[model samples]
Target chain A: MGGVITGVDLLATAVFAVSGALAAAEERNDILGFILFGTITGIGGGTLRDLLLGADSVFWLYQNEYLWVCLGASLATWFLAPQFNSLQKLLLWADAVGMALFSVLGAVKAIQLGAPAVVAIGMGVMSATFGSLIRDTFLNRTPVLLAPEIYVTAAMVGAVSYTLLAFFEVVEAIALPLAILFGFGLRACAIIFDLRLPKYGDGR
Target chain B: MGGVITGVDLLATAVFAVSGALAAAEERNDILGFILFGTITGIGGGTLRDLLLGADSVFWLYQNEYLWVCLGASLATWFLAPQFNSLQKLLLWADAVGMALFSVLGAVKAIQLGAPAVVAIGMGVMSATFGSLIRDTFLNRTPVLLAPEIYVTAAMVGAVSYTLLAFFEVVEAIALPLAILFGFGLRACAIIFDLRLPKYGDGR
Candidate 1:
């Protein structure tokens, strides 16, 4: 049963790494930077998670192969970066999908750890953003999370949806798709439409 | 008994925060950035530690006063950054002292949580270096840990010393100062002499 659960986590990590590699690629970084960003984006949050849980070594530290996977993903993105440059809309689409998947997976891990709903949401955000946070930090940009952006809100929705579905014992296969759709779909729409949370005293 | 331990922890946190604020002050950043750097530098590692441990809320989150303290520290540094520039050497000396105190304190906390010696040592390193890591991240410089500098090794020795001292039934008051003195003293000496660890595969 746990094995079934862990497979989702691995998939989520791979996608998270891809997103990181893609971001670095956006800046046309060298190969070393790409892989470094990709791996950090992938492993940063989970490493913290395992360390806190006092689980045996960090998850990637034990598997070690995951490191190679991050490198491979970065290499793939390196080759793929320029190809997608012409397909501008497609790149945005890919990021949206990756965010959705990682968010749900993060919530799932938190639930597995027996955390309450609030904690599950926090973990979901961690899974989705902390790596990117590190990447932005390295790039010397104000982090996206700190910006007036729609990113974390999307992860929260995904996490909340997952938690509600689990509350009712929905089959994971069914619940996952719904959560991803809600999370990424909302995010893409927000980005595409220039939607924003209304600030206090917005003209609207 | 525990009250005294808590006092030591708070004092160390204050010292680290002061050094962090001073660093930001030296850069002459605006008020917001100073507060941001100071708070994050002071509480960042402990906040991270708490979050990773699956606690219901972050430690600082429960204590709102910590935020004000950090901000005040930042404000203080704002006035002092120029003053500190003249005493740049002394500020770094303060940082070393804070690092030494944190290494032992962090190790003690890890031990309290039943962490193994290696894990305790790692936590100590994390505690000592995490602020600098964040500072480097935000400042867009390569982190100090990546260098072959003797920074973390000094903390490691302190952590090991504290652990062994506790195992041998040494009093906290006595053991802590000894560990701190050895670590901080060594580090200070190394910095003064511009010393570094032997590079791997150096002529032995």
Candidate 2:
């Protein structure tokens, strides 16, 4: 990867790490828990994705910067936690943005690894959801993905759309942003309209 | 690995999986939870160790038989859960057996990957502890390793012993059993005499 693209990835990862720490804080966990949550949330999904792809090494292990980024993000959040608790909705937007970026990136990575289409789809979901799932486990709570929300579905939309673009021979730059936008837009729209999936009690 | 070695590994893994499923059952969780706990507790530690050492693809993914072992062990425990729960004291012996074997195996794998001693130490502990940590996470219980009960210390002892034997060019057939004996002995001692690290709250 080039220097500029790597820089962008770093900033995006910081956002995800902060979201993770914030989630731990919401549960009133301690400092070690916050750091653990931040690191897992930041790198957990990508680690699984890379392992499956047979990439050189898990990205964070090769690059020390990611560790520092997660640690810094965790500490910063710890310091500013009291003030930010009031703006919970704002944190949701940050999480959505990170999810969009990660979800598309996952699909792109799987394509790069030459996995079959369905495997790519699975990788995409793994990339977007594994971290939060791990974080929830540590907090002893059910994962948001398993709880029936606009979670994995949003990533599926992102991955499927991205795969279609690649199928159509779109430019890398164009396809990446398009997938991110589609994922984020759908998630945002769902939140704004409270669009939840119908459950057992709902009429067919 | 040779056929005989592979057979022994599978047998040990089956015993460990049975212990994990029984642990979950004792907690009174459902069948799905039992399977989840059994599988993760059985394989996750080794997978983590492999990833860290950059070993070949995880053992479970390549070998369908390993998955079947975990599934079978989980099912068997789920059905006869009450019978096994009475054997909790004995089940701890099974865990110790798994930890001992896994620690030496992990160190050997790390050496194969050309990792240094510290990395190998990390791998050994990871192999012994990762699954139980994952299991505890799902059960919303604090991890036993985190309790500082000389658990990882015992794994490290076995790992370092294995490393020294490998360095001295000792035969693996002799060295591995010695390492396993060392670890299992430590754990059995800890459990039998109720030995634990002193805590500040214990009025020391």
Candidate 3:
């Protein structure tokens, strides 16, 4: 069970790492910048969550595989940049998958650690989105999560769903997959339809 | 002994919270933005350090006094802005003092946790500047630490000085004040003389 969870975690981390490296490439940053962005983005969200949850150490520090995976993904992205024509779409899909996986993972961890439901959901959203926030800040762009998109909303919905399932004593195996699916499906639809939640605009 | 250290910590948190609130006010952000930025800036650097050092939880999260101090500072800034003509100068000095105090505190904590000197110094630098980094990112400006200012350099120098003193068996009473003095003095000079390190300009 732990091995399967770790597998999903590493997969999400690798995907986010690639997204971060691609962002660095788009910004015309150098090699060091690519690696820095990739490593930070891959672990940023989980690090914040662990810190908030009072975990002794961050996950990546204890798990060498996560760091190596991020490095490999970054190097691959850097080397393949010229041929990668659909960078934006690729980033979107990769980020969506990462968001889904991490949200479920974060919520599960927070709940197990005895956080209230609301706090657990908040952790899930933070875990899903903060890496991208850091990436955007480093690249001198507004964070996409702060945009009027269905991004964070998708994560929140999934976290709530997971929490409800757990409250009803659903097995971890069933709850986890369904949570990821719901989050990913919402995000994919948002991408396909360009969906966005309403925002407070300038008064007409 | 612990009382004095806690006092200094709370003082630094309050001062940085004021700086963050002032920034939000300058940007004409809402009340929530003022509080949010204030709380984040006050705790951001320390949070990063504790996470890196594998602390069970963030310091502010464990101590409610820190959060209350931040909130009070932000509220004071919000109400006092109209009458405060020396906001910029005030911000500079408060920030310098806060940077000095946080650098020493972060270094001390990391050292106590058995981190190497280099890692302790890095934590010091991170603690002194990361709050402002977050503040600048949110306000859509470049972080001062990223500029060729004497800012992060001051913290690094102080951290190194403190580590060497501690390693040499100097008492905390003597080492702490000297470290803070070195950091604050350098930052004050930088502010007074507009001193900055040379930039990597595209030389002709």
On a 0 to 1 TM-score scale, where does candidate 1 land against the true structure? Answer: 0.57
Q: Whose TM-score is higher: candidate 1's or candidate 3's?
A: 3
- Per-prediction DockQ, in order? 0.07, 0.12, 0.15
lDDT of 2 by residue, A1-204 (tens): 345446656776787788888876666555544665676688777777888788766776546687678879987887776665353575577677777777877887788777778887777777887777776676566666665557778888888888889889898778877887898888888778766777678885
Q: Write the per-residue lDDT of candidate 1 for residues A119-170, one digit (tens) a residue.
A: 8888777777766677667655566566555788887898889989988999
Model 2 chain B: worst 10 consecutive residues (lDDT sum): B195-204
- List model 3 lDDT by residue over A71-96, tens digit each: 99999989987786888778778888
TM-score of chain A of each: 0.85, 0.88, 0.93
Tell me the tens digit of each residue's lDDT in model 2 across B1-204. 456456756766776787778678768878987787888888877778667546557888879898898899889877776654365664577777877777777787777666666556545755776666676766667655444355766777778888888788888788778877887788778777766654212331
Question: What TM-score do all the candidates reach, one by one?
Answer: 0.57, 0.62, 0.61
Q: What does fnat come to for each candidate?
A: 0.08, 0.09, 0.23
lDDT of each: 0.70, 0.72, 0.80
Candidate number with greatest DockQ? 3
CAPRI band for model 2:
incorrect
By TM-score, the better pick of 1 and 2 is 2
